[model samples]
Target: MTWAAVSARRLARHRLDAPATVGGDPVTRRIADVVAGTCGAHAQVMSAAEVSVAMRVAGAVRGDVRNALWRDRTLVRAHGPRGTVHLMASRELPAWVGALGGLDADRGVAVGEPYLDPDQVAALAEACPGVLAYRDLTATELTQALADTVGGWAAEPVVDAFRDHLPRWRWAQPTLGHRGALCFGPNRGREVTFTSPARLLPGFVPMDGPPALRRLALRYLHGYGPATPAEFARWLGAPRDRCEEVFRELGDSVERVTVAGAGPAFQIAGDPTHHELPRGVRLLPYFDVFGVGCHPRSLLFAGGAARRALARGQAGNYPLLLVDGQVAGVWHQALRGRRLRVTVEPLVRLSEAESDELAFQVQRLAGIQGAEEAEVETGRVTVGPHA
Candidate 1:
C-alpha cells in the first residue's frame, strides 16, 4: 500500500537488487532475462541501453548486449513503447509485436489531419514486411522501395522530422513495427538498417492482438504494478481509452488496490502486496526503464528530487540518482580518451557510505563504457533539462 513497498518490489523485479542471472551462457541469457523482465530496454542510444542492461545483470559487461542482439540473436531491437526504439527479447517478440500492433494507430500525437489515413498506413505497413524481408536496408533504400510500391505520396518528406527530414514511409516505420512488419537490423557500418519480425523469427507468427495485448498488460502490471490506464497508455503511447479497454479485458486477471500515495490503481491478481523496505543507491542511465516507469510522481520524485532530477516532469531526459527507490539527484557523463568522467549532483545529502556506494557505481559505469578508469566529481549538475 505504501510507495516504498511498491518501489521495493519494482527494484527486485527489475533485478537491480541482485543483478539478474540465468542458467545458460552467463551474459547472453542474463541479458535476455534483464530485457524481458523489464518488458524492454530503451534503445534509442543503444550504448546507453547496453549500460542499462549491463548494470542490471551480475558481471555483465559491454559487448554482451551486442553479442546477444547481433551474434547470439537472443534479442531484437525494434520500435517499442511510446513509438521509440527498444531492445526486446527475441523469443518473446511475437507477442510484443502483436501487443504493440494492437494499439489504435490513430490515437497518438500524430492524430487529426496531420495523421496519415488508414489507407496510407496500410500501404506503408504492407510494403514494409516484403521490402525488408530477409534483407537489411537503410532509410533511403526503404523510402525508395516504398515509393516504387506505393507511389510518391509515401515518399514525400511531409512528416515532422524533429531533428531531420523524414519521408512518409520512414515516418510510418514505427506504426509498421507495431504491426510486426518492421524492426531494426544490425547496423551496416555507420548507417542503420531496417528489417522485419518475420525475418527475425521465421517460423513463428505473432499472437493475436487482443490476447497479446492482455498478456503484455498483465506483464506490465507485474513489472510496473498498481499502475493506471493513463500511465500504461502513456508508456505504450496509446490513448487512455484503449488502455482502459485492455484493462477491462483483463477483468479478473487484475484487482483494484489503494496505494498510500499513488491512490486507486490496478495490480495483477495474487501478486505480492507486501514488499521489503527498498535500500541502496543506484546510478541509472537516461531512459533506464526503472527510471521511466517510476510512478506516483509525488512520492518517487519528492520535493527537491522533483526540482533537481526531472526535466520538466519527463523522467528519462537525464540520468537518475536513486536513493532507496526515490529519485535523489541527477548525473551526466563524458569520456576523456580512456578515462570516463562522471559528475553527480545529489539533491539530498549523502552519508559517507552512500558516497562510497556512488563511487562503486561510477566504477561499474566506467567498465560498462569500455573505459580504462573513471573519475567522479561531486557538485552541481549545471546543465538544464535534456542537457
Candidate 2:
C-alpha cells in the first residue's frame, strides 16, 4: 500500500469500532460509526439533518422528531484539552474525570482572559446545583443570579475575580466536546438552562488512582486504538508509562500493523477494507475528535499539516475542510444579518474546479446550520500563535 492508503487505514482503524463494515454505502457506514463508537458515550453535536440521514440509511426510526430528541443519548458538559466543552460518553465519565485530575486550571479562561478567583470559583461551585437550566437568561440575568447568591458581584467582575485558580482534576476522554448538550439554546426571556459545573465536575467523585488511569487508557485505545504510548500520553495529558499499562492489559487483542510506508500501526484485529470512503462533505465543528485523537501530527495530516492546523495553540481555533481524505483547507461560517457567509482559508491556492467544489459544499453546510442563504469566500491560510 502507498503512504496515503496506510495513513487512511490507520486513521480509519483508530477512529472506528469493531464488527463493522465500510466501502459499502457511505451514508450507511457513517451512521453505524457515529452510533456505535459513541452510543455508550451519548448523543454528540451531530446536526439534526445528519442524524436524519443516518436514521434513514440505517433503517432505524423509532419515533417522530420529539421522540427522537428524547431517545437520543443524554449529552453532558465535560472539560479537557484547552478548556472547552466536549460531548463525552456518560458511561465513561468516571474514568474521564479521574484522568483529567488537576489540569482544569490549565484550560485558562476564554482566550486566557483573567476571570474568576479561587475562592469565588469555589463559592460558585458550592452554589451550583447539580444541573442548572437558565431556560432563557440574558447576560444581565445570569449576573444578577450570581450576585444574588454570592456578594452581588456582576458576571464579568465575578469571572475576572477568580481567574488565578487552578483545577484539581483531569479528564480521560480520547477526544473532548462529544458529551455535551447538542447546541446552545438561544437567549430567551432572561433565563436559559445549562448543566451546572458541579454535576459535571469529576473532582466531586472519589476514585482510585491506577484503575481510573487504566480505564481511561482502555477507552482511548478502543476509540483511538492502534496508537503508541507517546501518542496516547499526548492526547490524555498523562505519562507515557501510564498509558502503556492499559495497552499491556489489552494484550494481543490488538494487532500490530504498519502503514505500507508509514511507521508501525496498532489497531483492533479487523480488516480495515470493511470501511467505506464516501465523497460526502462534512463541516466538522471546531475541536473535532479526528484531529484531537493523536499527536506528532503524522497520524492525521501529512508531515506539516498537523503542526500548521494546530499552530493556533493546542486548542484548534479553526475548522478544517476535508476533501477526498486530505486536508483541503480551513473554513468557518457566520450568519450576518440576512446573509450567510462561509469563509475558506486554503493552505494552498485552489484551482477553479476545487474552489467551485468548496463553494458548493459550504452552501450545503450553511443550509444545514439553519442559515437562510450562503456565500463563499476564500483567504490565505496561516499557522500562527493560538492567541
Candidate 3:
C-alpha cells in the first residue's frame, strides 16, 4: 500500500482539535473517553490535568473530574506511561497495568540489586494489599502500616532504591488496579490516600501482556501517530528493542507514512488523511498531552517555538499559547479575587482575529477555573527561557 503523506500542520490540528471552538456541546462527554483519547491524561500537576480534560469535554469543570475520580469510580489515578502519574479510565486499567507492569519489571531488573532483596521485596508486595485492602490510607499512614506489618525496612525511605516504592511495595508496581488491590482515594486533609479498586470498581480483570501492549501502542498512535518506534519507546519509557518487537507484531495493522519535510513515520492503517488546521488561538495547560505526547521534537516545536515554550529541553514547564495550531507563545494565569489575570508572552505578533480568539479562550479558561472575570494581557515579543 502506498503510504499517505501528511503535513505537520495537519497533524497538529488533528491531534489538538484545533478548529473546534470552546463552549460547544462537548466533543467528548465521558471522563473515561477523555482519558482514553490522549492515551492517558497527565496528572503530575493535578490542576493541569483537570483543565486538559475540561478543554475537550463540554460542560466539564474541575469538580467533574474530581467526581469521576472519587465519586463516580469511572477514572483512577495510577502511575502510567513514562513512569508518570496519570488519570486512566477504570475499565482500561487492566491493559495499562499489564503493559506498564512489564515495563516496571524491566526497570527493576535494569536498576539491579534492589535495596531489599527479592524475598524482601516479595514480602512487602504481598503485605501491601492486606494493609490497604478495604480502606484508604495516606502516604504517612500507609508507610507506618507497612512498617508495622512488614518490618522496619518497609518504613525506611530508600531514596536510591526508588522513592515511589518507599510507602508500600505494591506502589512500586505500575498499576495499583492489577489485583483490584488499590486506587487513589480522596485526599484526607492535605494528604492523598489509596483504597481498594475492588471496592471502588467491581469486575476489574487484568489482561495479558502481549494484547495489552498492542492496545497501548494502538492508542498511542491514535492520539500521537505517524510516529516512530523509538518515539513510542521514549514515550512509554520502555526499551526501544521491546517497542520494535511490539511494532513488528502489529505488522500491517500500521502503515509507514512520509511526513512533509520529515522522514518516515507510522500511523494506523485507516486513519483519516484530511484534517483541518485549527484557527485562531488556544491556551494549552502545562503538560497538556498534545504538547507532551507528540514526538520528533523538531517537527512539533519547529520555528523556534521549542526554545520559547520549553525550558532546558523540558516541555510542560509553562502553558502554551497556540495561534492557528502552532505554539506561538507561552502564558501564565494568576487569580486575584474574582478575576483571573492571564499574561501572554508571544513569540510572534498576533493578528486581530487571533487576538479576539485569545480573549475568548481566556474567558473559557476563567470559567474552567471558576473565576467570574478574566483579564488578558499580551506583552512584547519575547522568546526562549525568559519567555
Candidate 4:
C-alpha cells in the first residue's frame, strides 16, 4: 500500500478525518473514549492533553477532561507508554501494565548502577501500593514513606535528572506504575502526588505477561499498523529484539505487508477498515499522541516539514498543522484570558475549503479552552519548537 493509504487509515483510526460524536455518552465517557481511541494522550502539559481529547470529539471542552480525571475518575493519570505522562482510560490501563511490564522487568532501563540494585528496585515496587494505597502522597512524602517502608536505600539521592539528586524510587516511579502500583493522584496545592491503582480501581491486577504483550501489539497495529517491530519498539521505548519476538509469537495472527515508503510491515491479519483519502485541516497541540506515534518519520514530516515541524528529528515538540493527513505547517496558540490567538505558518497554501476547516479547528480550540473570543492569523509563526 502507498503512504497516502496508510495516513488515511491512521487518521480514520484516530477519529481525525472528522470529529466523532459522543452521542448521548456522558462527558467522562467521551473523554475516556477519545483517550482510549488515541491509545492514551501525551499529557506532560495537562492542557495539551485536554486539547488532544477535546479536538477529536464533536463537542468536548477542557473542563470535561478535568471532570473525567478528578470528578468522575473515569480516566487516571499514569506514567504510561514511553515512560511519559499519559492520561489513560482507567479500564484499559491494566492491559498496558501487563503488556508494558517488559520494560519494567529491565532494571537497566532506569539505571545500571550498583547503587540501585534490581532487588532494591523490586522491593520499592512492592512497597508502593501498600504505602500509597487509599491515600495520596506528594513526591517528597512518598519517597520518605517508601524509604521507611522498604529501606533507607529507597530514599538515597543517587539518580539525578533535575539539578538536585532524586531518590532511585523517584527516578523509577514510572516503572512502578507499570508494576501496578503507582499512578498520579490529584495535586495537593502545587505539588503532584502518587497513588496506588489497586485502591483507585476496584480490583486492579496486571494481566499475564505474554498474552498482554500480544494484546498491546494488536492495539498498536490497529492504530499505527503496517509498521515494523523496530517502530513499535521506538513507540514503546522497549528493545527492538523483544518487539520482534512478540511479532514472531503472534505468527499468523498478523499479516505482513509491503508499504511503499515504509518497507516490510505488519497489521492485524484481517483488517476490514476502508482506507479513504485523509482530507482535512487539523491544528494539533504540543505532544499530541498522533504526531508522536506515526511511524517512518521521513514520510510524516516530508520535505520542509522535517525542518519546520520537528526539533532534532523528535516529534511532539512543535504543534502541527495537518493538511490532507500530512504535516503542512506549524502553528502556535496564545491564550489571553477570554481570548485565544492562533498563528499558523503553512508550507503550502490551503485551499478555500481547507481554510474553512482550519477556521473550524480554531473554533474547536477556543471552545475546548473555554475562551470567549478566537482569532487566527495565517502567516509566519515566529516561535521555535515548544514555544
The 0-to-1 C-alpha lDDT of every candidate, in the order given, reads 0.84, 0.45, 0.72, 0.86
Name the regions of candidate 4 deviating beyond 4 angstroms: 106-115, 273-275
Please give the range of 10 consecutive residues that has the lowest summed lDDT in model 4.
106-115
lDDT tens string, model 2, 316-336? 445666554555566666667
Error of 1 at 253 (Å): 1.9
Q: Mark the 10 consecutive residues where model 2 has the least summed lDDT.
A: 168-177
Off by over 4 Å in 1: 22-26, 105-115, 162-164
Q: Per the 3 Å backbone cut-off, how many clashing residue pairs does candidate 4 have?
A: 0
RMSD of 4: 1.7
Q: How high a TM-score does candidate 2 get?
A: 0.58
| Residue range with the least summed lDDT across 10 consecutive positions in model 3 | 1-10
- Candidate 3 stretches with Cα past 4 Å from truth are 1-15, 18-29, 111-114, 160-181, 380-387
> What is candidate 1's TM-score against the reference?
0.94
In model 1, the Cα lDDT at residue 254 comes to 97
Measured on C-alpha atoms, candidate 3 has an lDDT of: 0.72
Point out the higher-scoring one by TM-score: 1 or 2.
1
TM-score of each: 0.94, 0.58, 0.87, 0.95
